[model samples]
Target: MAPLEYLRPSDEGAAIALAEADGRACLLAGGTDVVGLLKDGVLAPSRLVDINALPIAGVEIRDGGLSIGALTRLSDVADHPAVRGRFPALAHAVLAAASPQLRNMATVGGSLLQRTRCGYFRDPVTPCNKRAPGTGCSAIDGEHRLHAILGGSDRCIAVHPSDPAVALLALDAVVRTRGSRKERAIPVDDLYLLPGSTPERETLLEHGELIVAVELPATSFAARSCYLKVRERASFEFALVSAAVALDVRGGVIRTARVALGGVAPRPWRARAAEAVLRGSRMTEATIAAAASAAVRDARPREQNAFKVELVRRVLTRVLATAGAGG
Candidate 1:
């Protein structure tokens, strides 16, 4: 392991300044993914700035919606009464991440900023585009059953490993970020960048930028939302296919709908075509099947992961039916 200097900043500005000063400095919150990266030798930061002392931790209801601070633990977010009552899909996604101990230690911002769980990328010896740009992606011709089927380019195909992000995309959540330049609000769905030419650039955040909080709108579909994750094992396993659906059906007709997919894309893939199919349509089996089909119409899966197309369709259909039927 590389010897690293640890700095604890008293305020958010100082933390941002330290990050801006040191080009190789990394922010540490909860140390869930950062610790793993350091241990695996995937990242060798010159310094680690601990943001635990920052006052960016809270779960409050404001502006007729929910505002969750960045440093809030996953366990706390999942167990919050308001989150469970209003955003069941988001809560379920949070609860379904990692293990109990990990969820207890992982922060909301850290979870969103977590790197890919690709075997090739995790191993420092492997040539991964995400880890070292221009080295080429090993998963292209290697073991890529867990790789992305959507939003992938020739350079990279690693799937994003965030369950909460998929749920947030369905819920239309907004991300609030702060930096040395200024503060800005970004849609949760727009925060991620597709691996086109630069595979190393994961998000749109700048050098000294930090996620401050996530704001969720108070939508009527919140009460009728669901998150379905399918994996090889029940617990302590990443999703092979996951679907998050939020439906606002009124008198047998759908007024609004949101659908997002995970474990099959470089980012949280929103099914806007599926939403278009559901809007103003009756909640029926045929309608649900059509919506599911629309969700994966443009999916481009690799040779080994072709089954993900069907798996994503099935998960979307089931989740849409369950959420629409109030089950």
Candidate 2:
């Protein structure tokens, strides 16, 4: 571990200014992911800007929607009454992530911004485009069982490791942030960037921009949503494939549908094709199967991860059926 400057900013402005002044300064909220990156030699920042003092650590109901503070613990979000009642999929996704101890320490913002669990990216000795730009991606032809099958570029194939993000994408959540210039509201779909040529840049957030809160809009389908994660083990494991499905069904027919997938793409993949197929369709086995097929129509599965193509389809089919049944 390298010695770095520890900065405790009293206000949001101070924190933003400190981070803007030093390009390599990292914002520390719960220290769940950042600490591990630092210890693993993946991230060596010049300073650590602790933002725990910035009064942004609660879940509030505003404008008939939910506003979750960026610093709110994952456990709190998972256990919040309103979250469980209104956005059950989001609650389930958060609860399915990590472990109870990590949920208590991991912040909502940190979870959204957490790095990929790719073995090559975490190990400095291995060549990874995400960790070192222009370098070869080790997972492209190496141990890539956990890599992406949908949104992988030739340079990188790492999957985004956020369970809550998949649900947020399905719910059309918005992220509010304060940057050096001005405040901005980024939709969950636009928050993450695909691993195109620039695999190192994973998100659209600019340098020194701090996520303040995530706003989930009130929707009829959100309450009927479901998040399903298929992992190697029962608990404390990242998903090999996951699906978040929300449906607004009326008179046994789907009126609106939102489907998002995780652990099979560079970012939380919004399955708009699947949603289009489900709209105005009856919730039957045939409809679910068609939608599932549409979701993976354009998947570019590698040799090692070809199983994820079928796995994601099955997961999406299950989630869609569950959400449709509940609706």
Q: Which candidate is the best by lDDT?
A: 2
RMSD of each: 0.9, 0.8
Once fitted onto the true fold, the runs of candidate 1 whose alpha carbons sit more than 4 angstroms away are none
lDDT of candidate 1 over 1-327, digit per residue (tens): 799999999889999999889999999998989999999999999999999999988899997789999999999999999999989999989988999999999998888888999999999998999999989999999999998888999999999998999899999999999999899999988899999999899999998788989999999888789899999998888899999999888888899999999999888899899999999999889999999999889989998999999998899888887898794
- Which pairs clash in the backbone of model 2? none
Candidate 1: residue pairs that collide: none
- What do the candidate models score in CA lDDT, each in turn? 0.91, 0.92
Candidate 2: tens digits of C-alpha lDDT, residues 149-170: 8888999999999999999999
TM-score of 1: 0.98
Q: Please give the lDDT score for candidate 1.
A: 0.91
